[model samples]
Target: MTETLLVTGASGHLGRAVINDLLDAQKVAPANVIATTRNPENLADLAARGVIVRAADFDDPASLEKAFKGADRVLIVSTGELDLKSDRRLKQHQAAVAAAKATGVSHLLYTSMPNPEPVSPVLFAGDHYGTEQAIKASGIPYTIFRNGWYQENLFLALPHAIASGKWYSSAADGRIAHGARDDMAAAIAASLASGSKESHVYTLTGPQAYTTNEIAALVSEVTGKPLEVIQLPDEALTEGVKAAGLPEDFARIIVSFDANTRSGRIGMVTDAIETLSGRKPRTLKQFLEANKAALLG
Candidate 1:
């Protein structure tokens, strides 16, 4: 029997990657996969491929429950809501969990961050931590993918920094590892389709961890660009981004990532990717080499 696999946020990058892995690599039948998105029309390609596409709006509980019906495993790709003043995302996740339990889903999965603790400088920690706790309390076997930062995240700062020949940072001697976003998706698809009933927590990460200085050197080596690493204090980091035209609140939140890095909350590594997917993850150097054109432009 083909188990029904419902993936939320199907229109997003990660969700689409997971569904593609399921169909192309995992060899799961298309009829067994349910792709849920707020706009069903965005998944026309998936629907054309015989995937069961449904409309699911996280903010509306009734729609979530309706979309969750008759699924064996459901992957709640964490919502994109990041409101600074409210718990909108956490509430949405809790509602999804409730809907899953009510619909009799056997296995549940969630994509979360590395360290979602109260002491972590990142304000969104509570949102993920709360969602994980909700899944545990739902009385269902669950798989929690504590996903780390992505190598593509470098695009947010590296290109601009390399262009100017200087990279600013508040992460002092802090090390961190980043998984390729698509590789993480493949590992997740493998686990979801494995038909396992054991509850587990997997921290999917890159093959190695690198500090700011090390990554700067790697970037310089890869692009042959003369890049300088400028370490700033937390306050200076916030002020720097604010001066760069970001709002003060958003700047502070962005600086919190550096503070979290400095605290070493996200530097851990694991073999969950290969262990689950049976494939080696791409290295940072390879990613840089492949995307060098985009980085330079």
Candidate 2:
């Protein structure tokens, strides 16, 4: 009997990329893979390709158990919700873990963040930290992919900055080790599809660190447009985001990321990506050049 691998959050970008890597790069048989999501219709193409598509909602224990049944390995993609005060995310994660355990899955893999300290200002780190602790206490064989910041996050801020010729941020002069989202996904897929026996925690990061100024310079160089990095007070940054029509809570969380980046909390670079994926990570310049047209327009 072939071992079945179930991947949650299959409709999202990272999840879909992992599925593709499992099939295209790892040569995993599609018949032995299960792609799951809350909405099953989103995975029609996967189902048509002989891959099992199941409906799995973290909020519903029965759904997760059903989705996880007959699975040897499971990858729990972290949910997108960032609200923790209500404890909804915690409940969802707990539900997934409980279902995995009850369904007798052999190996459990989780997508987590590089949460060195629990008190770091990164808003979503706490959720990952809590989930990691839960997985440890569960006594199930597991692997934790502690992913670092994504270089694409800069693109989210680029369009507005390019339009105004100024990149506003609270990351004054500090650098961040931002890895590509696809690299992180590929690492997770490779580990899951590998024959490794022991459980491990892989800290996925980029090979080099770059500051906001350096990133802005890359944008300028790629687009041939002058761009200036403007450092702002954290409170002012939060206020500016709110003034631009973002929710106060969301703006505060984004500004807090700047504070964390500015304090050198996310500045550490590592060779983990190359070590795991056996290929050098895409550099900031490469990323900028590839996405230059989108960044400028």
Candidate 3:
């Protein structure tokens, strides 16, 4: 029997991209793929394409286990819940890992960020670390992909910066290797469909790393939009983010991203994307060039 592959959070950008690549590029039969989300209605298109769509709530273990039934492999896309007090992100991840184990998944995969070790400044690094530990302790074969920051993440900061002709940062001289979200998704889909039972961890990143200044220069070149890179102290950036209407907790998290970067924790470049997907991950410049319009706006 062909392995039944299930991807959780199918309604999410990464999960949906993975499922699409699985069908269109990896050539995995739609009949053998199961897409799980909280709202099955969101994946109606995939369902229409003969993929099984099941409602799986990470907070509801029974629902997750039922949704994962008979799956030979499963990917747990990390949840967005970052409630520090409740530690809901780690709990949700643990719940998913438990459900995957209970349902007897042969192989498990997880999406994690680079340098989720304790020393990382990112407030939510703990969530990914705990999830990886849980997946390991579950006694199932697993692949942990420590995904790099998405090139698309620039959308969060760039559009505003471009409009004002100023890019402010606390990531002084820090370099980051940004992988295109879709490229990362495609690579993940390839690995999922490859049916490799080997349990291992890999870091996926773009072929090159660029500092904030370099990224800004490239953006300036592509969009003909002049930009000035303004460096600020971590505390100042945190305050700025807070002043921009983000919650205090969120501001801290945003600042910690720069902290992590400044500490040289997120600049690792690897060939894993090409090795897995059989294609080079898009360069940051290419990503910028393609999304120039989006960046300009």
Candidate 4:
């Protein structure tokens, strides 16, 4: 009997990419891979492709149990919910762990962030840190992929900055070792399929760290548009994000991310990605060049 590798959040971008990498890079048979989401209908194509499709909602214990049944390995992609105080993500992670334990899953893998210190002040980092603690206590053989910032996040502010001709940020002059999301996903899939039972934490980051000004220059170079980087006070940045129509709470959380970056909290670069994937990560210039058409459009 072939061992099945189950991946949650299969409908999301990272999740879907992971499933593809498992098939393409690792040569894992699609028949032995299980792709799960809250709505099984979303995965109809995957089901037709011979991949097992199941419905699993992090909030629903029974659903998770059903989805995880007979799985030898599992990968829990962190959810995107930003409201940390509500404990929704905690409950979801708890359900995943409980289901894994009950089903006798051999290995559990979790996607997390670089939380060198629990109180690093990144709003979302706390949730990942807490989940890591819980996983350690669960007594399950696991791997924690502490993913760094993604270069793709630049898309969030790119269009406006391109049109306005000014790059605004609260990141000060601090640098970020932003890895590509697809690269991180590939690393996670590789780790899951490798079948290593020892608990490990890998900090996946890009080959180098670059500042906001450097990124702005790279964007300008690729798009042939003039751009100037403007550093703003954290308070002003938060207010600006809110004025631009983002919810005040969500805006504040993003501003906090910049503030954390400014404090030099997330500036560490690593060779972990190359070590795991056996290839150098795509640089910011390479990323900008490859996505220039869509970025300019």
Among all candidates shown, the one with the greatest lDDT: 1
Give the distance in Å from residue 60's predicted Cα in candidate 1 to where it truly belongs: 0.3
Instruction: Count clashes in each candidate, considering only residues at least 3 apart in sequence or on different chains.
Output: 0, 0, 0, 0
Q: What tens-digit string does per-residue lDDT give for candidate 4 at 1-297?
A: 567999999999999999999998998999899999998999898898889999998888999999999899999998877785687876788789899988989888998888646678787676788788888888999998988889898788888888899978989888898889999888888887887879899999888888889888888988999989899998898889999999988998888888888888888898888877777889988888888887776
Q: Please provide TM-scores, in order, for all candidate models, with all chains considered together.
A: 0.98, 0.96, 0.98, 0.96
Q: In model 1, which range of ten residues has the least summed lDDT?
A: 115-124
Ordered by lDDT, highest first, the candidates read 1, 3, 4, 2
Model 3 misplaced stretches (Cα beyond 4 Å): none
lDDT per residue as tens, model 2, 130-245:
88888888889999988888888876689889989988899988888888889888888888887565789988887788888988887888888888988999989898999999
RMSD of 4: 1.3
Better of 1 and 4 by lDDT: 1
Task: Please report, in order, the local distance difference test score of every candidate based on alpha carbons.
Answer: 0.93, 0.86, 0.92, 0.87
Better of 1 and 4 by TM-score: 1
* Tens-digit lDDT track of model 3 for 58-149: 88888988999989999999987888778788988899999988888999999998889888899999999999999999999999999999
Candidate 3 residue 74 Cα shift, in angstroms, is 0.5
Runs of candidate 1 with Cα error greater than 4 angstroms are: none
Encode model 1's per-residue lDDT on 65-151: one tens digit a residue: 999999999999999998888999999999999999999999999999998977888978899999999999999999999998899
